[model samples]
Target: MSEAAYQEKVLEVEPYGIEPIPREERHGRARQMFTIWFAINLNVVTWFTGFLGIEFGLSLKHAILAIIIGNLLGAAFLGLTSAVGPIAGQPLIPASKRAFGKIGVFGLSFLNLVNNIGWLAVNLVLAAMALQKILPLGYHSALLILTIATLLIAVYGYNFIHTFAHWMSIIIGILFIIMTVISVQNLPALLSQSAASNGEFNLGMFILAVAIAFSYQISYCPIGSDYSRYLPENTSGKKVWLASYLGALTVCIWLEILGTLTATLGMHAGPMDFFAKLMGVFTIPALITVILSIFPVNAMAIYSGGLAALAMGIPLKRWTSAIVCGGIGALLVSFGGGQLADTYKNFLLLLSYWIAPWLGVVLSDFFYYRSGLAQNSTTNGWAGITAFVIGVIVSVPFMSSVLYVGPLAEKYLGHADISYFLSLVVSALVYRVLLKFRSAAVPVKPLQFEE
Candidate 1:
């Protein structure tokens, strides 16, 4: 397609790069966030996250409470960051440049790029495994099919992703509801039976469960604004925040609760197996829903990964970036296979370790320092970078992962990983103190872009 024609078909065809979106091109409903986030959270990976809570030794009651607390906390950050979209009129990375400065934002962009690609590969592998269970195809074949499908959607970019997610929310939402109804028939017996937790309350395990759930949502902060950047500038921030928050929170809570119930009942099989057991003869539809849901979720990952790469000074077009990112992810999945499974827990913990500190700095800069202005400034990026590094360093002694346990974590904390929480608090507090002493090195300037 010619450039002009492609621009006509899709809104914001330029892809904006680090530029703020022009007012004339901004168009979309704030409430669409409901469908976008709702659909995004409906997937096998999310269900697996809930399953991990049980594996970490939480009883059904504690698991549900932890999931609720984690989602609520994470959703608050997610919603606030997303609300910056229409106001800043840029993707998450560029908008973040306002706080981190041009150089410092690159640090976040690089980490975000890695996280996005890692998430895409993880999603594809899990989705492909579920597909293999339903069809006779091998894992490689299913992975290939899913990769191509997701790439096609992502190459079309933002408008298409929004439209796709809107319709998907309805379809997947109804299907999962039906699946839940079928599964609930056995809930009475499941609730009456004792969880295999040895009847002891473990605070350390409970905190770990909350961290897992919180990390899942916070992982999206780097890309939270990507979908909402096209909304009209005058769109109510409150509406955007509420819509996204409620949408993600509701679905996350429901699915995790269902997952907890299933695990508690000893039907601790993977998502497809549990669905097949409950749905019986209607298992085909359930399987189809699970497979169909992968596209929108993975497409978001591919799309946002490309945007982060672009922000880091990669000159590729958005579509080209999508293709490149998806190709790399596919290659990783093909070679890594089962080895990736072993790293999944550590991968998630590693994500929290970096992202929580990053969030602390970004949120503190925007709310406390910038007075909520979305304008970029010329400052020594070193201060924020120093604060972030210090946060990570301090968190080391508190981290507990299979890869390595910190001395403080193992000796005193009973193996609970509160490193993420510690990093968050430390980074924000340090950034605030540093900002008071440091002044901008150059005048603030608005970003410039070509028409």
Candidate 2:
């Protein structure tokens, strides 16, 4: 292939697949991360996560606190993962090959691929619902439209994803501002309810609120670096971290608060009803705004999912993998159109189960056992996979969900899930300890500087 073919074109499908982005071709600044992430989280799902805070029985004040705290914690990890992108120059799941070994990473890769599909279903469902409001299309037809639109962006790959998000952030930002201005009328309803439940803040409910929000934000961590790998090799990791952290943190908290108020105003109805009531004739416009915003997030899920499938040794080209993922997501939406509220909550909780421990392994490998990440030998990292498995096993007793609340959560923690935290801490500590006995045959040199 000609060298010019390697140059990322403005209006072309991204030719690159899962390969590490070359430094010579790398472009963009860390701050661009701000727009991409901010745009991605503007959808109703993140808003619904906040509404869940109230649904879980926390006071509005407590829910907002939980939203802030959860986003703070989750965004930190999100930032940490994104910061490694320019240096690692590989897709997030592929970079894990160093820690999990080529074989062990497959399990994690599979988990990631599952998570991506679930998210794709989630975002597409949200968009389809919104699309159904404005267009003549039914839910299935709207879903079909969204599936094709998102697949195009994902197949086009990196540069297009970034460009799409940057513009969406500005457009969505204005639209949400209008919605928020109209939403101010509902704030009194939320505040009044807050005063009633304000003193009865249940610790279990509060923790659950934080966990759900944290889980949602941290859900982005696994795919955080996928977009940033195209940045210049010398990109400042700190700036990248800050950009991603603030971008997600800002919009997430904003939407969650707005969602809480919407829920309160709707009473027996839901947030969407609240939107319809509040906006009156403008309801169609609001839905259109929502439909437009979903593409950025759906694109991210499909794009990263394609990479995750490739990382797991799926023998297809990147674009082909995106097609498969989009098809599966559309199929999932067919079965999941009803019971969205319960389905979405359980989905968020389940996502935390595998991702937290996986985070433990990746963070340890990238930061503490830095040498392993730079090494080409995937067979040298069994210690990481071992520790990761142990962490997940240990966390099983503490798992809490409507699906199955673990005994430890019921017996001791009042059914508030702390398993996510336990998994991360245990995996990190164990991996650090195991590193002492673990040795590779080749002389190792830690990656001390950015790529």
Instruction: Report the CA-based lDDT of candidate 1 relative to the real structure.
Output: 0.77
Which segments of model 1 are wrong by more than 4 Å? 1-15, 195-198, 267-271, 336-341, 369-374, 441-451
Task: Per model, state how many residue pairs clash.
Answer: 0, 0
* Count of backbone collisions in candidate 1: 0
Determine the C-alpha RMSD for candidate 1 after optimal superposition of all C-alphas: 4.1
lDDT of 2 by residue, 144-163 (tens): 88899889899988888888
Alpha-carbon lDDT, every model: 0.77, 0.79
Most accurate candidate by lDDT: 2
Among all candidates shown, the one with the greatest TM-score: 2
Which digits, one per residue and each the tens of the lDDT, describe model 1 over residues 28-115?
8889898899899997667667876677777789889999988998888888778878776787666666457778788788878778
